[model samples]
Target: MLYINQQKSALQASTLADLAEQLALPTQGVALVLNRQLLPRALWAQTPLSTEQDHHIEIFQLVAGG
Candidate 1:
């Protein structure tokens, strides 16, 4: 099982892109971090999730404020 935003998740995904899709994340104004590293949007499709290891995925929403 993997952790999403510090919460336990049973959802299984082959790639980062798949995970994002499963979560219905916005295309913009959001950032994804995997294993303490910032994952670029372009790499999401190529990044694979390993079942052998537990992963930690963090999603940060971009906000605009004064």
Candidate 2:
């Protein structure tokens, strides 16, 4: 079980990258955080997310407008 932005989700993954893919979210122009910690893009593929673990994950997207 995982709580993304305080919303309950049942998705499990071995890495942050995998979790993003499973959620079908755009990897570009976005950022991921775990437990109030900033997650780097380069580390996403190695960062861990497990079914047995409960975490507070947040994704922030950058929007550009002029």
lDDT winner: 1
Candidate 1 clash pair list: none
Candidate 2: the clashing residue pairs are none
Give one digit per residue, the lDDT tens place, for model 1 in 1-66. 799999999999999999999999999989999999998899999999999999999999989998
lDDT of each: 0.96, 0.85
Off by over 4 Å in 2: 64-66
Worst 10 residues of 1 by lDDT: 57-66
Q: Residue 22's C-alpha lDDT in candidate 2?
A: 91
lDDT per residue as tens, model 2, 1-52: 7889999987777888898899888868888999889988888898888667
Best by TM-score: 1
Q: In candidate 1, which residue ranges exceed 4 Å CA deviation?
A: 64-66
lDDT of 1: 0.96
